[model samples]
Every structure is written in C-alpha cells, then in structure tokens.
Target: MAYLTLFLTAFAAATLLPAYSEVMLGAMVTQDYSLWWLWFWATAGNTLGSVVNGVIGRQVDRFKEKRWFPVTEEQLEKARNRFNRYGQWSLLLGWMPLGGDALTLIGGVMRVPWLNFVVLVAIGKGVRYGFVLWLVLNTAGVPSESVPSP
Candidate 1:
C-alpha cells in the first residue's frame, strides 16, 4: 500500500503535471518504508511518465505546420539543433527543474531513440530517488519513533 502510494505519487510527479515526489519519498523513508521498494517503484513510475512525454513529443512534428500548433518552426529548429549538439547526455538532466522537463519534452519533440530515452530517463530519476533515500538514511541516523508507523 505504501509502495502503491509512492508509485502513483512518483508517476504523477514525472508528468507535466505539477508534483513533488522527492518530498513524499523522503517522508516515506523517514516513516520506515523499504528503501529498495520505494526506489524501484518511484523510478518505474517516473520513467513511465517520461515515456508518456516522449510519445507525446513524437507526435509534435506532424502538427507543427498548423498555426494552432504551440511550437514555432524556429523553436522546433532550435530544439533539434540543440539535441543534435548534446546527444543523449542531455537526457541526464531530466531530473532537474524547468530544464529537466523541457529536456524530456524536447527529447520527444526531437524523436529520440526509444531505448536511449528510457535508459537515460531512468538513470536520472533513479539517481534522484537514491539520493533522497540516502539523505534520509545517513542524516545522523534519524530516530524511527519520530517517523510515524506505517
């Protein structure tokens, strides 16, 4: 049940939807959820969300000719050039703010290889969750009682 909650939380957070899984994850860890489970579920959920983003982005080029399309031709061109410049390394930033989401979306817009997208996005989100769990576990050994029972 706790893992389910974290899964949904992580999934939604990964989307363009506004969310903050890190806080929820940290709180859960302090509350004594399994570190391994939380990390696995969160990473899985977040990566799935990014895949949604990438799939949505893949369709963008088809609609680009329409004036109603949100992205301008110039903008698309710039994004393509940037992706070309950075290669898959740019995907590592998917865990970051503003730029991170944009990177994910742009990856879709640029039609990044599916495998590359998954591998990189997973790594980025995994690192984020791992760090959060590490911080909780290593922070002077937090008292378990302070964290409410699960």
Candidate 2:
C-alpha cells in the first residue's frame, strides 16, 4: 500500500505537476519499507512520467494548432537546436527541480536517440533516489544491516 502511494506520487512528480516525491520517499524510508523495492518503484514511476513528456513533445505539433499551449514553429525549432547541442549535459542535470520535464520534452523534439535518453534519464533519477535512500536509511533509526550501503 505504501509502495503504491510512493510510486504514484513519484510518477506524478516527474510530470509537469508540482508534486515532489522526495517527501513521500523520506516518509517511506522512515517507516522502514524495503529500500530496494522503494527505489525500484520510484525510479520506474519517475522514468515513465518522463517518457510521457517525450510523447508530448513528439505530439506538440498537434497542440500547436490550439491556443491552449501555443508554441510557434520558430520557437520550437530554436528549442530543438539548443537541445541538440546541449542535450547530453542537460540529461545529467535533469534531476534538478526546475526544467526537468522541459528537458525531457526537448530531447524528444530534438530526436535524441531513445536508448541514450533512457540511459541518461535513468542515471539522473537513480542518483536522486539513491541520495534520498541514503538520507532515509541513515536517519530512520533502522539498523545498518538492513540498509544498503551507499
């Protein structure tokens, strides 16, 4: 049950939504949930959310005709060029609070290789979850034997 909540929260947070999964992750860690399971579910959820961002980017042209999310073709082209030039570095920083979703979308729009995007996104998100796992494991009063070493 707790794992489900954590997964959903993490997934939503990865999207353009403003929710933060770290809070739930912290709480779960404090509760002594299995660290491995928690990390796996959180990573999976977050990655799926990021994939949604890519899908949206691919379909952005459809939305361009609508005023709801207006993006000029010129602007889109500029964003694509910028992403093409800087995408590798950008992937390294996608775990940051802002622009993560935009970065994923831009990568898709710029036609970055899917495998590379997945690898980079997984690394970024894994690092974030790994950090949170460390914090929770250390602070939750769980015995060291139960927690995986960083």
Candidate 3:
C-alpha cells in the first residue's frame, strides 16, 4: 500500500504536475519502509512520468501550428538542432528546474532514439531519487522503534 502511494506520487511529480515525490519518499523512509522497494517504485514511477513528457514533446510539432501551445516552428527547429548537438548528454541534466521538461520534450520532438532517451532519463532520475534516499537514511534518523536491532 505504501509502495503504491509512493509510486503514484512520484509518477505524478515527474510530469508537469505540481507534485513533489521527495516528501512522499521522506515519509516512507521515516516510516521504515523497505529501502529497495521504495527506491525501485519511486524510480519506475518517475521514469514513466518523464516518458509521458517525451510523448507530449513528440506531438509538439503538430501543435506548433495551433498557436495555443505557443511553440513556433523556428523554436522547434532550434530545439532540434540543440538536441542534435548535445545528443544524449542533455538528459543527464534532466533534474534541473528550468530545462528538464524542455529537454525531455525536445528529445522526443527531435526523435531521439527511444532506448537512448529512456536510459539517459532513467539514469538522471535514478540519481536524483538516490540522493533523496540517502538523505532519508542518514540525516533524518529513523525512529528508534522502527529501527530493528542490529
């Protein structure tokens, strides 16, 4: 049940949604949830969310003409060129506040190979979740009752 909630929260946070996975993660760790399970579910959920963003980016070219989204063809071309120049390396910085979502979508609109995108995004997100996990495990100090005898 905890894992399910964690996954959903993490997944939602990964998209443009205004959710925060870190809070869920911290609470779960504090509650003494299995570390491995927490990490796996959070990573999977977040990665899935990012993939959704990529899909949106793939369709951005079509929306370029609609004007509702405000992305122009020139902007798309520029993004495409940037992706071509940077290649998969751009995904490593996908956790950043400004360019993260844009990078994911640009990669999709530029038709970056699917496998490459998944791997790079996964690595980037995994690192982010891993850092959160470390914080929960170390500095937060698990409740005395929750900590099993060594």
lDDT (10s digit) by residue, model 1, range 27-131: 777665667788999999888888888888888878989989988999888988988899878998898867777788889988788999999999999998888
The per-residue C-alpha lDDT of model 2 at residue 50 equals: 84
Candidate 3 C-alpha lDDT tens digits along 31-98: 65677788889888888888888898888767677858777777778888888897878987776667
Q: Candidates 2 and 3: which is better by TM-score?
A: 3
39, model 2: CA deviation in Å?
A: 1.1
What is the lDDT for 72 in model 2? 82
- Once fitted onto the true fold, the runs of candidate 3 whose alpha carbons sit more than 4 angstroms away are 143-150
- Give the poorly placed runs of model 2, Cα more than 4 Å off: 138-150
Question: For model 2, where is the 10-residue window of minimal lDDT?
Answer: 141-150
Q: 1 or 3, which is superior by lDDT?
A: 1
What TM-score goes with each of the models?
0.88, 0.84, 0.88
- Supply every candidate's count of residue pairs whose N, Cα or C atoms clash at under 3 angstroms: 0, 0, 0
Candidate lDDT scores, in order, read: 0.83, 0.79, 0.81
TM-score: model 1 vs. ground truth: 0.88
Q: Candidate 3: minimum summed lDDT over ten consecutive residues — where?
A: 141-150
List clashing residue pairs in candidate 1: none
> Which ranges in model 1 have alpha carbons more than 4 Å from their true place?
144-150
